[model samples]
Target chain A: MTQRPSDTQPQGEGNGSKVNRRGFLKTVAATAGVSCLPILQTDANAFSLDAFLQKHFYEMSKEELERVIERLENEYKKTYNKKEFRVGVDPPLAGVRFAYALNLAKCIGCRRCAKACVKENNQHRGSEERGDQIEYIRVLEMKKGSLDLEKSNHYYDHPVPDKDSYYMPVQCHHCNAAPCTKVCPVEATWQEADGIVVVDYNWCIGCRYCEAACPYWARRFNFSKPRIPDEEVNTNTHYLGNRPREKGVMEKCTFCIQRTRKGLNPACLEICPTGSRKFGNILDPQSEIRYIIENKRVFILKEELGTDPSFYYFFD
Target chain B: MGPALYFLVSAGLVFASGPGRGEVKTVERRSVLEDQHGYYPCSDCHADQETNPKPRFLQEEHDSPLEWEDEAGNTHLVEFGEKLAIGDLLGHGGQTGNRRRNLVKVGARLDVAQYMEEQGLSESDSVYVLTHGGANLWCLDCHNADDRDYLRKLNGEKLSFDDSEYLCGQCHGPIFIDWEHGVHGRTNGYWNRELDQKDVTRRLLCIQCHIPHAPRFRGVVPEAKPVPRLDPVSEPTAESHGHERHRGEYDRLGPHPWVETASTGHAEEPAHDGEKH
Candidate 1:
């Protein structure tokens, strides 16, 4: 095998001076910086990337976190070209209220909605590093001839609707009986009060228990730094939706909690062309979504598992 | 030369392929470049393009001759209390069956051109059929929609709205950008578990916020330009006031950076043409 050029090797034609002098210097400086630092450098008092993220998401008070929020706000505006932005720190959540619903009949195997969701949620479209499988929604195109529960499709080819086809969009159920939550050795993943399951990405260890524990292949682990471009990024990132995730953490959809809980509709709901999905407060009958669930023929996926999912699907 | 060439193209009669399998030998059918399938013929609506050679011929053949030239070299025909340039109808300026109190609207469009040519008159100045209206919209701009139907012209031809998005995209680049980003209009699914399956429908970017009837070119984006990063709305717009009824000024409202470029709850119109929910 041909040997690669050595950073310090002299190969200037017949002149034997090092051609890659600059590369050699950079490598040397990097080595020196790494060697000089202790294995665990104490920040005078004591703080680390993991330890700080371990704090409750809402632990930072207004006075303590004001500077941080402002900094992120400015960063977002500068990057997105938005002006006069209002970014609120999470005051607190009564509980992580998560809900989802899919319409089986109207989902016509058109994955235009899937593409929109991918863009909105910042799921790396290409192969993700081990811990980073970000696609929260998968459209299952079932054959019109076979409606078999066991034999339905999870794969879709281009130029859809071969006579008879139905689309079923899948995402994390945020199970009330969350298997992944049970197996977290580090207490990193927890169920919020409002029915949403959340993982403190910073607190997660590289343990794969959560991955194994879940029946619905929902959770994904990030093995490397996320590779989303700065421009395509949705800068109004919540912990769940648009933010660039870190290495070695598990992530999934948050129902666009960043937008939904604040009285805004989820991005997918906002852009559906054929009106095949629905959302609203389950508690409020007057809510458009509630009226549908109460009045329509509603059913959940994998009902036997008894996850008691907030999501429900229905037909007329 | 431009005018002369146009005049030649107008007068030169040629048979051409038209909508569907049939042959289209008229200028009217040939003018529309895109929507050949939906081409409405000239004589089908009015007389044949051959019948109207120019203002003089149109007047003599149709039994009327006039010109609508004024001191500024063009007559100010009025309609909707606005001056409209009818230069698209060149050389055929005259009094028409369309008029008010025997006087022209300051900027009339269709009628005066026909009337002036019928009168067989000329002005010291050349005609400026019309300029950009107060809305600053050129006649050829939004009117290029592929499905337009033209009534009468000697050339017997029509045009398309190919360059239209550029005109609309000018003020609404944000909407256009958002559109390109797959965020502006409806494409897929959204969940409001509260809504019925049929309730969620296509999202309308242009006709949604802007009333569809006039759909006057508004901001750069379609009416519903998504400011994703959450710049607070200082005050509610007429379109948004119903759902986002809290009428107060926002301190700062904007989208996040890195990309260019919301809710409803209320008794929406029972006949909302947009995608539901």
Candidate 2:
């Protein structure tokens, strides 16, 4: 709203117009309100008007994105009490289409990758008092002779490679034809140029449509405000990847977007003691993923559903 | 040609045709001996020791003595060679089997003259009979007898311990191909070399995962399992309880004191609005 000083002015400035007390008060009030506008825009929680009115990641201009990043960095630094916190927006590299491969014969069902995922991303550490546990990778122990997922056990706690069973770890596949993206009412989640399906936490409307639509059950809804220990928080976060998520929003694996964009492998891949996980740009003919897809007996989960996931599982 | 010469020629041929045939080498490998081997640079212990070239059961340096219980309920210290024979008889599949395979495969080439003499057996005895070819591998088949420091290839070419993969590839041809293609072994660091020049990709050497004597990977106790997702009832059962004791009180609480104070410092200010309006 423009200042009402002009409307209050009875005459021109040089003609001695500001004689009335009421008009003076009005002008002073208007100027004071305008001066306090910025203070009122932000609250005690650091939930700023800028963040509330922030545009979609794709729609934001370079300058706007920079300002948003700065605001997020400040917010996260304050929340986590970290001296070095960064919110990176590194985009997809040229001629790179990311793909992942897992050697079924090699995975030992150690769940080290799952633990590493929780630490790398700032997922909620669950407890009896506050029950919001979230992990990206779920290693399923399947029977030796069956491909039936329903028969697989997720809670086997013993030395792995049970003589009669095999382990199959399932996670967000980042499908080429992602069903989660299609079901997002607010278009908050979508597949990126590099074949990673990312969710804009700010844009999600907490509708849970995408969670229901996902065939792999890859999507996770934050039932309560995510509770991450300040010390355990991963300060090196990406805007759309492992950044702290809010209550009621959806989040999933972005293949460690913060790390991968800078040429580092995903946290799970690095922590796999079995060396079963392999990831690389499928577009690169010399890449490991390409070699696997070309030579190994690779297969995608639920291929008949036609999700066409970039992730592949192969036997030795 | 003799069996040794034929084996050498075939091993050389395989090395020539193995992976990394034409590709620009990008995978940086760590030195296997320095990183994994506890007792390396054999010269450290064998510098003044006499070299015994005979093919016989190792009774001293290489022997890992095992405790054995005889039929009379008496315990005895059994050497690795005797243990290997016992394990082979019992059809065991772990360390014992691995050692037996390695020793038997190597012993196939050497004359085993000392072994035959100790057992009081002739060349015609089935127990002491030696088979030729790739199956009969011995310690000197890989290790150089003249020089204790270097390993010798099948073709009698000396190789440093760092180049042990070349020797391993002679028999494990297919696995070596997979390892070179970056599919079988563990590789850490940058997946995309073009993006970051400083973070060089390091692939784990074969010896890093498998012991030279016992190549089989023994079963490991895995990390803890995930918390089961079930409805919370009035009473919490053992099945429903998570690893709560492992976590600290700070993790279960609301916003931490420092964060709470930093974000909500203005909340402490008195409410003057009640009288102002």
Candidate 3:
């Protein structure tokens, strides 16, 4: 990426030459150091000093937060050509801890839930030849009478609910002991009080450590800017959820933070035709998730690792 | 033209019809179904038919049938009528004792008329009839023949399109039971029905997804198909690994098949070969 002219200021010849010499040497040294590493550039070439020095989510003042939101809203409006686009930062609801469960027996492997997730979350739609887009949900088609993950196939194109097979859709477990957050060298990702693990796109350095840490492979790293058609852009966005991401950042499902915080169900939950997916406040004993956990023989993937995933899968 | 002159001209034209040509203006009666389903005039079938009060077949009478005998040695058969009312239709799950249960409500018909009047619409503008894969069945099989209303309950209750499960339950009792328990169809509301009623309106109806005539969930287009998993970075050396046939081998084993190979230290390649947009 080339440095923008806005990063420098005009100066007198004598002093400017001396400063230029020093900057040239500094650039040479920095370039040499970067060439040996695989670190990704987290920002676009346009260098805004204020954005570069923006504070973390917890450390931002009220005024600064407002300024950030306005800036992002303007940028998105210009980029998507949607003047009415809004970016919201709705805080998590009090006394709500979300948990998810999937009934394997009922899931027909239709993949409608996965399709709805992409649209609701504003995920990039990849082309037929190139599967560059990120999908938060993956419905794995497994042979019937088997609980093994290795035998599952996610790319099967045949009609679903095969006579001899079943399906299991998986996404971020949002585990209590989230290995993704722990492995983040920078505190760009963290679990909210409501148990949703969220990524701060601007703060993330795009190291991809979290991707490697997750056993379920839930985390998706943006190798390039995500492409969403202007008309297809989901205007409803959350700071920690479906807001458009930058060129390089790590993101994963946050249980539709933009919707759930407002007492709405996640897109996938609403799209399941078989009533297989269940989501609710785990703390509320009267919640459906609570009933499933208590009554159904529920289990989590990679349980031996003790990740304590909020997501559970049961055969019932 | 000036506004007054335009109004005068239009009003003069309206009054200019000569008394000698005193034919009254009449609307051209165009059947709304003509454009969509072709014209069908009632006269096509009713032409030259004599008005008879009794059904022809019934009036023929059964051979040697006992009749005109009452409890006091006199009996009679009630007369069958020629003109059929809307209530005469029977539907699925057998008969509701009263014929009125099968009848379309007069209010509903009037509502349609009112709507058409408001919108400047005309008669028989739509058809709800569907062909279920060329099955030879009449509309009266599952709906009232005259008004197309559905009857699944015997207590004279009519079901809306949203109440498809109950309507379908007429013949599919087991499937209806499964749907009631949230096992057969989609459920979107808050799992804890006892809690907030926020999700009540959002619950999806069965007809919203499945076509009632052909209740099958269609597969999504290829563009929306689930992508394959990213290929694992490493695999066990075919020579070094043994006992590959064991049922629970991968589960109980220490080293997983997808573990990073000792040679490659976290290779972070793009999952797909597609060029970045």
Candidate number of the best lDDT? 2
Give the DockQ (C-alpha) for candidate 3.
Answer: 0.08
Candidate 1 Cα outliers beyond 4 Å, as residue runs: A1-54, A58-88, A91-98, A128-133, A145-150, B1-277
| Candidate 2 structure quality by residue, lDDT tens digits, A76-161 | 77777655788889888766788999999899888999899999999977765544688889898887788988667776777776
User: Which ten contiguous residues of candidate 2 chain B have the minimum total lDDT?
Assistant: B81-90
TM-score of each: 0.45, 0.71, 0.57
lDDT by residue (tens digit), candidate 2, B113-135: 55556677544443321222325
The best-first sequence of candidates by TM-score reads 2, 3, 1
Residue A315 Cα positional deviation in candidate 3, in Å, after optimal superposition: 3.3
Q: Residue B136: error of model 2 in Å?
A: 5.6
DockQ of model 2, rounded to 2 decimals: 0.20
Task: List the DockQ of the predictions in order.
Answer: 0.03, 0.20, 0.08
Q: Write the per-residue lDDT of candidate 1 for residues B190-237, one digit (tens) a residue.
A: 223222234332333332223222243221211121221122343233
For residue A125, model 3's alpha carbon misses the true position, in angstroms, by 2.8
Mind sharing the TM-score for model 2? 0.71
lDDT of 3 at A164: 72
| lDDT, candidate 3, A111-223, per-residue tens | 88878888888887755444467888887777778878776766666666665778888899999999999999989999998899999988999999999999998998776
